[model samples]
Target: MASARLERGVVVGARLLVAAVFVAAAVPKILDPAGFAAAIRNYQAFPYWSWNGLAVGVPMLEVVGALALLSGWKRQAGALLLGGLTLAFVALITSVIVRGIDIGCGCFGQSEAAESVGWPLLVRDLGLLAAIVVAAREPGPLRAARVR
Candidate 1:
């Protein structure tokens, strides 16, 4: 019984943490899409035209998915979206590193204090992936644990 409680505690903690990070990251970009667009341009991952649209859309999607995860109403869908975003970021950052591109991650939007793309950033994202993987592997619906 103790073990079960411990595991559930861990799952709840992970979901809260992941949701917090996504919400924090999304808010800045949502507030400053022009800055985000400039940062995306630095990565040169997508076409020039798509950068603006992505900057506008990605943060909104992040918030929606995060809220879903936090609320446990559509946890699976949220996990899928967040997992996909995390995976895509890993790939994008890896490509940037391979090409010797020196740029901030723009993870929390473009800022003087933005984290640069590097192995550390990759590791952090990987940790988030692992957390999401754990959440995804839960045996039943998360709504069971959701507070009324």
Candidate 2:
């Protein structure tokens, strides 16, 4: 019984930690929509007009996902969305690395930085991907083990 309780606590802690990271990342983009648009443009992921839409929309979705995870509301859906988002980010960063594109990650920044793409960014996203996958799959001991 004690061991199960400990495991449940650990799982919840992991989910909270991942949720917190997403929330923190969203704050800066929320503060400067225009800057985030420019950052999205820097990725060259979409057409000119679409960049603005993506800039505005992506962060908002992220905020929603973060809130869902934090609140443990519709946790399974939230975790799935978070996992999908993390996978998309991983793919984007991988493409940038492959194409030898030296640009600011702009993940935390509203605008580009005067730095080059490197292994660290990929590594970070990979870590997040792992966390998202774990959270999605497990959804914590308490939630999973409870009577349905």
Candidate 3:
């Protein structure tokens, strides 16, 4: 019984953490789309035509997924979506490092001095990815206890 409670607590905690990250990331992007677009352009990962669309779309997706996670109605789907987003971010950041392009992470809103891309960012994304995966895989508290 205690183990089941603990598992539920952990899952809930992970969900909240992931949701908070998405909300934090989305708010800045939503508030300053132009700045986010500029940062995306700096990545040079996408074509010029796609920048505007991506800048708008990504944040909206984050907001929706975050809300879903919080609501628990589509938590698994949200976890999958956010996990994919984190993976894409990790890939993009890694590419920036490999290509030796120095640019702001664009994770938050525009800043006079944007945080540069580096391993730290990659590690952070990876950690988020791990959390998402763990949450996704974890059965609900009742189900988990039954399986064990």
Q: Estimate each model's TM-score.
A: 0.92, 0.85, 0.91
- By lDDT, rank the candidates, best first: 1, 3, 2
Candidate 2 is scored at a TM of: 0.85
Off by over 4 Å in 1: 139-148
Compared with the true structure, all predictions reach lDDT values of 0.89, 0.75, 0.88
The candidate with the higher lDDT, 2 or 3, is 3
Determine which window of 10 residues in candidate 1 has minimal summed lDDT: 139-148
Model 3 TM-score relative to the real fold: 0.91
| Least accurate 10 contiguous residues by lDDT in model 3 | 136-145
Q: TM-score-based ranking, best first?
A: 1, 3, 2
lDDT of 3 by residue, 1-148 (tens): 8877877888878888888999998999999999999999999989999999999999998999888877877878988888888889999999999999988899977877768999999998999998887677554667856788
RMSD of each: 3.2, 2.9, 2.4
